[model samples]
Target: MKQITILVPDGQSTLSSVACIVGAYEVLMSANAYWKDVGRDEPFNIILAGVSKKAAFDNGLLTVKTQANIADISQTHLIIIPSLIRDFQEATKGNKLLRDWIAQQYQNGAELASMCTGTFMLASAGLLDGKNCATHWSAADTFRNLFPKVKLQPEKLITDENGIYTNGGGYSFLNLMIYLVEKYYDRQTAIYCSKIFQIEIDRQSQSAFTIFTGQKLHGDEMVQQAQAYIESQLHEKISVEDLSARFAVGRRNFDRRFIKATGNTPLEYTQRVKIESAKKALETTRKNINEVMYEVGYADIKAFREVFRKITGMSPLEYRAKYNKEAIV
Candidate 1:
């Protein structure tokens, strides 16, 4: 059986904390289910080992552990950290013993993994240097501010180099687990687990920003309706006059309220929304660049390309290629 160990830390995020514990089970159980259906041996013997009993700090019913000594961690193929405290103080302050243990483990050649803020722990352990890692967007600034030595990508759901694996925010622990299942088993088995978990496996190439947030162009209900109407009518020419008329507001009032709510003018918001849509289509679909441009209501391919590169820092083709190479599967 493959030994998988998850280091539960103190003050872990509630979502990530639950994911690390429950998510690990979902991965192992799903893998076992798949194996039995296909007549293969179960491949995982997972453990939720605390670095120490006192290594953990309890918040209400939530208990976060400090790092444990490597000798207690046992022979494990993988070490997972779901999430860590909000600040580095929680990591470094409450857990000196835990930090030392993590350092020793990395030197011993174990595959290190993290989800969300847990990347902070791995970074603190010094395993993230020279490796690309991801974390929650909210924590993106903090991670960068704390660990300048590590390369942090805020947009990716997961990143892997050599044996170190890190993921951005959300239920990506499930994605990471699916990745592990496939690595040990096969694509078929991974697909089976994904179905069992009701996950969107095809969303492998999807980015952190697009997957988490949606196009909400307007903040107020009235402006939202107008913006929704505008998005639906993207193929047709739209104008501020049309928006004012449709929303039953004066042109000046509409413009001011729209900007106040969305931080952008109506036309600007429309372009941004379209560009976002185009980006999603480019990354997730097999459609050609021209097709994506048209799909997002851009009749001018050159203008779309320029705007896309400016907004997303990459052209449609480059975005697609980058994510296509990333294994969402």
Candidate 2:
């Protein structure tokens, strides 16, 4: 029999877009059912561990009950930390009781796991030092700034360091679960579960695609609209006023609210979108420097080059020239 425990924070937001408010738990449960259906001969048990009932449901983010305290974290093969608090202050100011439980479990040989922003909780517990880890890429800078001891591999779908396993953001939790099944049972079992869940089974590896972070804003319709606008106009020169009008909010209000909801200002978020877009162009097309820049909405080559260098540590030409696989092959 294999037992797993999930640690959900108290007062956590139940909003589907907030940290820890995701559908990953449902996905994992479905995978477990498939595993059992395929006669994988393993008893998979999941326990929802939390602090207090009020803490667990303070924000309606979690629909589960608070379990017996951290002392109940006994004999589990895997302990999962799902999405964590986004604010660094909140993450660092962790629950002393929960942190101790995580540390004790890991020291006693429990395989630790994290999904999306959940890596922050693991890092806060000092579990990721000197280990390669992945998180939602949007928090790449913040994570690096806060946890300098941890090695940040921003491009991975999942990273296995020591006995701990962590996946990047989005549905990558499924990727981790599938990987676990294959490792513990066999490839056949994993593939059978994949088909049962109707997931694409032809993936050679999840790493081929960028790991998506699962951070989302709940009730911030303005942020959502601004995000949509940013995506559609990645090639346009967008200002705060443009974003404000798109969301129909005043500029000042939009700026403040966007930052509060998304942890990034409109300009900062737009740069990230551009950099990501530039990365795609570099990987999939043979477009030249100017063409790629223009495609991602940089009319001024010098400024675009500077921004790319600052964000990615490489100029457009340099990044494309250096990492293009075909060029190397």
Candidate 3:
């Protein structure tokens, strides 16, 4: 049996924190059952291993009864880092023992997968130092700021490289789980679990679902002002030169400071703000695609569609039809 260890970090976590571990456990168990029905032996020996045998989440609403602690198990086939709901720094800070165990496990040939903000923990373990990983879109800037050595692919629903895997934020964990199922079992078994669990097995990008919220917590007053002005004038063509002049900073200095604060260039930030507005419009308003584009300050149809697709991985109409139930009808 493949020893699959799910590391349950002790802390307050998102609503899905406990659920994801249980979900992965149940799915693997179900896969084992499927193997039995098909006259095959079980594949996974799943364990809930952590620093302690018991980890309480959500203020003791749920207490996970882990069978093994980090020291109890010397090695395993896989280590899953569940999502942490709190601040990444604080969350990782409290789990140094668990983090060290994770690093040791990966070094010993055990593959690692982090779900949602669980990427924060894996990053803390220094497993993602030079590797590309996926996390929630909202946390992209923060992840970049904290772990600049790691490549952050916030748009991908799942990223699998070497022995590490990371899924995008939230319920996208299901997609990553299904992906692992496919790799561990067979494609046919993965299809069965996807049907049983009602998970989209082929989803690759979370960009369409992400509503781009610009990072403003960098604490630079001038940079924050530039951000606010650009957001305030989403419909107008605001140039970097204009923002620099208005903010009383030099052109190169403004560019440097803006990037330092926001992890995005001024022009990229402006485009995102405009696109975020367009996304909201597409989701809630009854405006046509072109109307939505023009409302977001994109007068050229080709440019608008291209930019939308580049950022969102979907066209405006596609995003609308996918998200807006009324639009579908």
Best by lDDT: 3
Cα lDDT for residue 248, model 3?
A: 87
Q: Per-residue lDDT tens digits of candidate 3, residues 42-101?
A: 988988887777888777878888888789898799888888875889888888888888
lDDT tens digits, residues 83-130, model 1? 665765576655555566666766777788887777887787777887
Q: Rate the local accuracy (lDDT) of all candidates.
A: 0.69, 0.69, 0.87
> lDDT of candidate 1 vs native?
0.69
**Model 2, global lDDT:** 0.69
Ranking by lDDT: 3, 2, 1
RMSD of each: 11.5, 11.5, 1.9
User: Whose TM-score is greatest here?
Assistant: 3
Error of 2 at 192 (Å): 2.6
Candidate 2: tens digits of C-alpha lDDT, residues 1-329: 67777776664333422334334445456656766777665456766676765354435544666555666557777777766656755754665566678888889888888877778878888999999998877677678767778987776667887888887766666667677667655677678767766655433233334423322534577687778778788788889887788667898998898776655678877887887788788877887788889988888999988887766666777777767867435
lDDT of 2 at 257: 82
Clashes of each: 7, 9, 0
